[model samples]
Target: MEALVLAWPGGEHAFRLPLAQLELLQGATGCGPEFLLNKLNLGQWAATEPFEIIRAGLMGGGMDAAGAKDVVSRAFDRHP
Candidate 1:
């Protein structure tokens, strides 16, 4: 798959990233989806809008596997 791209302020440089990298990019580089979107003043994508859309966005199909278990456990580790 193609690596995703992330840019720095002023477009000075960009990094090619993966979806999995999102798990820790905010802490490591001080630039993740939330910060970048808000910094750019494009908060619409920072989180789902129109409240009603959020539920469908967060819902997912079942995955009965060890990795799936880890994922479910981690969701509880996070706060709403």
Candidate 2:
């Protein structure tokens, strides 16, 4: 499933996506934030294979796989 439960409106916060879905997106998304964001944003108008753009953009932005994962992990740790 290419879906994510956005931060809940109020009271409860349930920003979660299935691990399998995330894994699929990870392989497709490469290292950019756009496809991921678009995915989290519902992906209604997203490209068919946005992962290509994600990979290209990540390469252009000079962020490799490890670096991107580090950033995400740090973000979660710092915020939570």
Candidate 3:
């Protein structure tokens, strides 16, 4: 599966990823704040709080409205 990596507006890192990539990362280091942040960018969420992002991820795992929101939120927060 193709993976997308998007970084917060100014963040050095990138977010956005495919399920396969997510799974790979999970196997490696588990879900850390950084990983969540990256996913948030991919989803295009609009919040910064970890819980909010987590919820977004859960709701948007399928890459629906919720997931987009989470990704945007992460990007917005990271944007500097």
Top lDDT model: 3
Q: Against the hidden reference, what TM-scores do the models get?
A: 0.24, 0.29, 0.24
What does the lDDT read for residue 35 in candidate 1? Answer: 62
Model 2 regions lying over 4 Å from their true place:
1-39, 42-60
Per-residue lDDT of candidate 1, residues 8-74 (tens digit) = 2222222333344343344434566566547557544433121211111122122233433344345
lDDT of 3 at 33: 49
Task: Give the CA lDDT, 0 to 100, for residue 40 in model 3.
Answer: 70
Model 3, span 21-62: residue lDDT tens: 455445444465476568777985443344444334433234
Per-residue alpha-carbon lDDT of candidate 2 for residues 1-80, written as tens digits (9 for 90 to 100): 22222332222212223444355456765634465677657855344344343333333344465653454445445654
Note the Cα lDDT for every prediction shown: 0.34, 0.43, 0.47
Indicate whether candidate 2 or candidate 3 has the larger lDDT: 3
How far out, in Å, is residue 64 in model 3? Answer: 0.5
